[model samples]
Target: MESGTSSPQPPQSDLLDVFPQKGLEPGDIVVLVLYFLFVLAVGLWSTVKTKRDTVKGYFLAGGDMVWWPGLFSVLMLAWIFLPIYIAGQVDMYAGAIFIQQSLHLDLYLAIVGLLAITAVYTVAGGLAAVIYTDALQTLIMLIGALTLMGYSFAAVGGMEGLKEKYFLALASNRSENSSCGLPREDAFHIFRDPLTSDLPWPGVLFGMSIPSLWYWCTDQVIVQRTLAAKNLSHAKGGALMAAYLKVLPLFIMVFPGMVSRILFPDQVACADPEICRKICSNPSGCSDIAYPKLVLELLPTGLRGLMMAVMVAALMSSLTSIFNSASTIFTMDLWNHLRPRASEKELMIVGRVFVLLLVLVSILWIPVIQASQGGQLFIYIQSISSYLQPPVAVVFIMGCFWKRTNEKGAFWGLISGLLLGLVRLVLDFIYVEPRCDQPDERPVLVKSIHYLYFSMILSTVTLITVSTVSWFTEPPSKEMVSHLTWFTRHDPVVQKEQAPPAAPLSLALSQNGMPEASSSSRVQFEMVQENMSKTHSCDMTPKQSKVVKAILWLCGIQDKGKEELPARPEPVIVSLEENPLVKTLLDVNLIFCVSCAIFIWGYFA
Candidate 1:
């Protein structure tokens, strides 16, 4: 592990470790974290007095949210998906350069630039600012990723050419003793069997996707944005919108790896003995440098930076969100609970302290992260999250919808899942070991496809099994059941009898003016006259009268011989135009998004 002047240059070997780049210095990491803290402080400072009055104000920004800010939050949160995808690209691209020394510098620069922009906006406006910036950033990322794909496809001479080239590469690898090869199926072959294969189909389909769902759906960092929505409809709509965006990445991230293989067939060969020895001596030195190298060497300059920025933006988006959410959870969930009646000023101060502590912890952890080797960042994060998420999801879901799920069940289930997950992780570590000769050789824990699936299964089974067993042994309190049933049950339906005809305008006025009529009014309009005839408590209408009665009934009111419904009273409306703060936020976000889009596009271009 040579240091200082002895450090090798980029593209010298695909295995060159990126930690030695010195770009993201300890100070830089600290600065990044501090930037987040500052942003949070500013946000808190603006709302401290308001937030002190209610939990909702602190947690949800008072919820009278506008469309632009809400949209921004959704977009910023959605940006998380980019980093999770790009981390894999970095791994793959670095791997591609291992064969040929055609790695590029623009790609890394692009990533760095994107991170800078994200940090700036996040620092400028807190969550609100970050969200608006993210919406535009997300669009750029999608465009940049897709553009790369299109160019790569055309470079390889289309899908048919890609397949032909792949097969030819595979055939050549077989003859010359190479590790690269084409699969038996076409491009769309998604389901690979885990039992007899290197990559498992079932593992990805069931195991990986489930953890993803849990992460994207239940994880606090992601879900916090949805919670911030003004209403449930907005929250649901925002989430679904992000879900649709999720389906676009397969083509963007994975296809580039395949394209790299086709274009640089020779690099796909086994690592040269010399490079392999260097890598073995310091595995962390070059393990994740592959994808960045490919991007720098291959893409045109302007487009290169755009793609790199997209990747960097992705990373920053996740880091900032995690930092903010972690601070939030620590302050609201832990600190506030301990000091239940803490003052607004005190809580804000406590939140800042927690932010500083978390940042420091993360900084300390970064070195440990750099020291470790193997596994893609995305996979590593997801696998670890899988172990932690299931039980939390179970408890939260049950607590929200099922009142019968007592605090005891919630506590025990969470504990059971955590313990089970930890035990499974330990067991898996002990059982699985690589058979390579080198001292540093270890099984690829993060890259293992089923890791998330395995952790999630263990966590889920333990939680449900423990919770269910506890449920029957100590039945839920009767009060709990009553509360649960109250929320869950449907209201009873009742029938009503028809009355004789009245004046048209009178009937219309009655229907319109009595808009706040009791539940019985709805029932009265629905019951048919013929059905009422059986009781003989009300008079039956003639055949033509029945037709008129049916028409009135459908409108949820008696016709009363009305030709038209009367106009209802004018509804009261509130104006927010006089609110200077609201106007400022609107102006800021609009300018912010526009400026960000221009800068990102221009810088990338």
Candidate 2:
């Protein structure tokens, strides 16, 4: 890699011409190929080994996964919600795309291939495959990320050197007397000036917590991972371990990003719109390319491919969790609402199809992601989330904690808050940020107020709306609040009389409008229901062709045409009990974890 030159250059010289372009070597290609094959192997193994014949098996991994894998799986998906872990996973997908563009790889090919490979296992094996593959990805990501972090720190001569050099990384042609293309004055601080800094102290303390609460507590993606745990103990263990893992990204991603800016300030910190456009095809700024630029220019051939694999792992981990959760939400919530009598098999098919459709739609949104928030992907994500998520978060929080929060209040509050946020969102799109050093032309609400502050305002308004509506509306039924609110979670479930199990459609049709069950008919129905209760190794019809059977096996589906509906079992009591010793250990660890987190924030502040 060439050192940064301070020598003067022609004003019109293309940035592309200024720096020599590099592509993946043969060894890099080999490593990347091996990584892909390994991922597919893991996916295939999970698909065959894991049970996925029922909704619980497919969507929640049968609630059987142990703590260790669940820990890594949660780390892969949930890291983005926490402030300290925010920069790590966001960099993965965005960094991967930037790396492809940097290497002059075919962008469309890369996107399609990545999404297709992810969709294959995700659609076929469901959440079990996602969790299994995520555990593997977590390992690869740690290795590759730590490897780069080591190389990065060495290149920068350690933390002391980084602090000295990062501030010096400024674009040569940056306009005098302007902050454009310069490192932030509070770059090293967590708590910054409330009014002027990119991340304000008050907003970080108050506003950021709203979305974080929503993500950790209510978001389907994060909750689904915990739902796969075997017991409360395993769930606690996984969550605690994931919390510990959060400390790694500060070293792995944040420091390396700073190192990239220091090492290649000319490219990563380019201020000239024309120069950035020529380099990354985005004139906003090339800061988003920091990590990718580091991987390409700083690493050896094989290691370069390993980091590529890491990026791929990160991308797949994030995407699979999202795809699985979205599928679950759509199938169980929307589809079930529309078709109450839809069979489990039909739900399964619908969920898988939804994933496929999501992939296709996601591909179409790539351009918008690439261009948003001055080409900084993480900022775009947070800003958009602020615009939409705070309201939903408020509703969830209120519904859980406040017994008085009726359905009408929650609904109207959410609608009102979302409308306000949506207006801000539309205005933001219509009046995009101007290029650095250009005039500020956006509205006062858009330009003067920060997104995080806007989130705080949104949340307050939502709380007000919910409270006002609930005060005037009729109180909710006791049954509705029982065992549902946080205060009532420990209350006993109000059991209702068990309804007789419905007969399978095939059996019902065969009976031919028998209005009353004679003793003989009841006996036959009981026998059929008993038979349906047990699991069978193979449920497909012998008459089906070998080809069709093979496809069904691959998809983890039974031949529903010949299958009998299983009798619904009586609900069992869920024991929240844990081994006293394990509980003590976890409780101790939680205190330690929280302490460490607080120390880091204060030290950084």
Q: Give the TM-score of candidate 2.
A: 0.89
Model 1 lDDT tens row, 1-605: 55567422212223333222213334434534454455445443443223222334444445544443343233322211112222322333332222122222343443343334333433223344444444555766788778888887777777766656654433122323544233445344555556645335666555665555556655566766766666544554465456446556656776666665555433332234333334322322232433443455466655665555555446555655654555557677778899865544355545545544544454344433333323234444555555655666566556545656766676778778778777655644454433232343435543342565565576567558556855776667654454234353332322334342323333343433333334455335423332533444323334347667653332123323222233333332322123466446545655665575455435423
Candidate No. with top lDDT: 2
Compared with the true structure, what per-residue lDDT tens digits does model 2 show for residues 24-113?
788998998899899988988888888898788899888798888885433222211212122223433474465465456566677777
CA-lDDT, candidates in order: 0.47, 0.77
Off by over 4 Å in 2: 1-20, 72-96, 503-543, 560-567
Looking at candidate 2, the ten consecutive residues that score lowest on lDDT are 75-84
Predictions: Cα RMSD each: 20.5, 5.1
Residue 1 lDDT in model 1? 54
